[model samples]
Target: MGKTVLVTGGNAGIGYFAAEQLAAAGATVVLGSRSDAKAAAALTSIRSRVPGARLSHVRLDLADLASLKTSVDALGVDSLDAVLCNAGVLVDGPERALTPDGHELMFATNHLGHFVLVCLLLPLLDASPAGRVVTTGSFVARSVKLDPADPQSANDYQSKRAYARSKLAQMLFGFELDRRLRAAGSTTISVVNHPGGALDSLTPSRPPVHVRGAGQRLRGLPAGLLLHGKDSGARPAVRAVLDPAVTGGQLIGPRVFGLRGKPRVEPVRGGAADPDLAAEIWAASVELTGMEPV
Candidate 1:
């Protein structure tokens, strides 16, 4: 597969590993990280693994929509086979923070930025033979309650809840996008996949190049050990973008209840997966971002 793929937040964690695997598999992998140094390091490591791999990098801060617009145009791609919206902020403070764009940080970075980026990249994706959009979500979505009135979690803010809600928004967008694309007779497939508890501690620590939270490291060692490592956690997302048999609107995750096992298609439930929720959120996202993947 000589397809070109973009991985947002491709400098570390699941994103780094996913970019590595995709580059090795012959896809022209573009790594988008906010830090230029981190992106360069990731590219170096990936090149060492896949000698002469086609790779590039761009600066993109998901918390800032202006950067998202400028960065995509400069990625040196006329088309893309797939895009992995894998970058996200997790475990912020309990207080509600705002991005440069003035929207809630977590929602803006994790969901809104990607929402606009995809809209801007529609032409490129549409030009691909089998275009795919894979969003990296999580199991925490099962426990989230997003208030449409305060979707930004401005009222009662908790780091975990905000993170979970952001992922839920991503899942809903993925499914809704598939529905819209099909209705418009487009071949682009939008798929959602989660890297269930793929911890940073379970992965090789790369110092400044990789961020490590002390508490997460302490807990992740035990939790990730009981489940899956970062490498294994990226499998479902990789499969979602690479597997020809994978269709849109289906979720892929660990075979063992999304904990630790081979990646496979898994069914989802709850209000987050509801069509009405998807429509409502989609409309809200459009109003907020002022863009849509037509």
Candidate 2:
């Protein structure tokens, strides 16, 4: 195996494609999905593309902390080269929802759940010579203003804003994680990436009834051209995982306006680069997931 890699939400969309490309590159890829059936199908698909592809499917529901903990522990793996926080949710509908962890759904799945997962899996990652954690962030993070007063969005809940906040949290966590890992003198690398636009399987946060087919089709057109293929979106993530030059606190993403292009080293927005916020989020996440720091 090239390296042991785990990708959350690898059942479909950009996650699936990223897993496919990585598996083809000879990595031992673990597909983490919420649905066992979906994961099985994704594994089958990868095998079809890459003969005898080394792949395994594990159940991981980003909205449920217990599920993540149980599934991760059951993996029975000693070490992991890289763990991709590729799962996400876009709450575009009118209603607001909460995760099983009692957090705002968007924040819980997109940020907190993965936050807990990564921290809990640190031991496995640390065992690798060059362990890395790649998190999928977004351009919307630029627009989001982290409201520490209302981290859960309980008092105020706007669909786009919540989603954006979650992405912002992911970015901040990646940066902060870099600092923490370096301080501990661990070889683990933590980095963030954003696809910029819609990938093949852009899943909406709300139920299907809330989305219009025509609107989704129209939105996906320009996105299809600008957003990038599954492999391209995976570039930054793969690079962050394998590239020796990617240092702590660096972001890897497209060079173009917002989408399809090569992976380039980038920086987190100044407004979003507050160490205080990162620390606060980190503490909050640890409490929320009940996962003690390593």
TM-score of each: 0.93, 0.88
Stretches of model 1 off by over 4 angstroms after superposition: 205-225
Clashes of each: 0, 0
Model 2, position 235, has a per-residue lDDT of 71
RMSD (CA, Å), candidate 1 to true, equals 2.5
Model 2 residue runs over 4 Å out of place are: 201-225
Q: How would you encode candidate 2's per-residue C-alpha lDDT over 1-294 as one tens digit per residue?
A: 489899988877768767877888889999888888888877877787799799998888888877777988977898999999999888788788876556889899998888889977899999988888898888888886887767777777889988888888888888889888888899887888877664543433212211326566566666565566555676777777667788777888887875668889876675457999988888877777777444
lDDT (Cα, 0-100) at 111 in candidate 2: 88
Candidate 1: residue 95 lDDT (0-100): 72
In the predicted model 1, the residue pairs found to clash are none
lDDT per residue for candidate 1 within 219-270, as digits (tens), equals 7776764586687888898899899999988999998867877899988777
